[model samples]
Target: MSWVILIVSGVLEAVWATALGKSEGFTKLWPTVILGVALVASMGGLALAMRDISTGTAYAVWVGIGAALTVAYAMIFGGEPTSIVKVLLLLGLVGCVVGLKLVDTSH
Candidate 1:
């Protein structure tokens, strides 16, 4: 389903973003290669999802999910700060994604 593809694409976006961070300015060869492959795969999945979903809505959801997941990953593994404000912001991002899905499905 298009929604499934979109979700997968969003997750891949998280993976690629983490890979990019690990690539150390692209000086690390393996992580950089992983980042490139994940980026391509995520984009391809997004293109497929766009065949059925509205571009504006799908893009917003995709980016929202990607950003939230990336931030969570960074906080958990990359020693990034996990303040209360950041947690609330991530929750708000999740709420936006849920709201978009609800509106999209109700149509």
Candidate 2:
């Protein structure tokens, strides 16, 4: 349950991150509002997940998911380059997140 919340929070983080880029210094009213709402929701979800998960573990998972998803989203929707290196990096990030979860669960 906590992991689910953490994952949702990570997704929200990705959403807001993309929104922030589109916001263009907050000049775009709709994007700016979306970004702000997403940011708050992400943080609130993180706080809820932290009640059950360790801070370090939750934070690492959140950031790893956010970064990997953000890059993937940019590549697919934001016209960013999706080179072999980028794919490899994303895989590496996934591995790191999995490793953390394994170690955390074992403890």
Candidate 3:
């Protein structure tokens, strides 16, 4: 399913984002490689999903999922500060992503 691929790509967006951070401006070899691979895969998946989903909806959902997961990952394991407001905002983003899915008219 395109939606499934889109979701996976969204998660990969988080993976590539985290890898890019670890790449340290591409100074690190392994992290840089990971970033390259994840970036391509994520973009490819997004393109595939776009075949079925509207461009705007797909892009918004993809970005929303990626952003929420990225912040969550940073807060949980990267020693980033966490707060109730941050959590609530992330939840709101997720809710909006789901709402987009629910209202999508195209299959």
Which has the greatest TM-score?
A: 3
The alpha-carbon root-mean-square deviation between model 3 and the true structure, to one decimal in Å, is: 0.5
Candidate 2 residue lDDT tens string, 1-103: 8889989999999999999999999999999999999999999999999898899999999999998999999999889999999999899999999888778
lDDT of 1 by residue, 6-30 (tens): 9999999999999999999999999
Q: Between prediction 1 and prediction 2, which has the larger lDDT?
A: 1
Worst 10 residues of 3 by lDDT: 30-39
Off by over 4 Å in 2: none
User: What lDDT score belongs to each candidate, Candidate 1 first?
Assistant: 0.92, 0.92, 0.97
Give lDDT tens digits, candidate 3, residues 4-106: 9999999999999999999999999999999999999999999999999999999999999999999999999999899999999999999999999999998
Off by over 4 Å in 1: 105-107
The alpha-carbon lDDT assigned to residue 65 of candidate 1 equals 86
Clashing pairs in 3: none
Superposed Cα deviation of residue 14, candidate 3 (Å): 0.4
**Using Cα atoms with residue i matched to residue i, what is each candidate's TM-score against the true structure?**
0.94, 0.93, 0.99
TM-score quality measure for candidate 1? 0.94
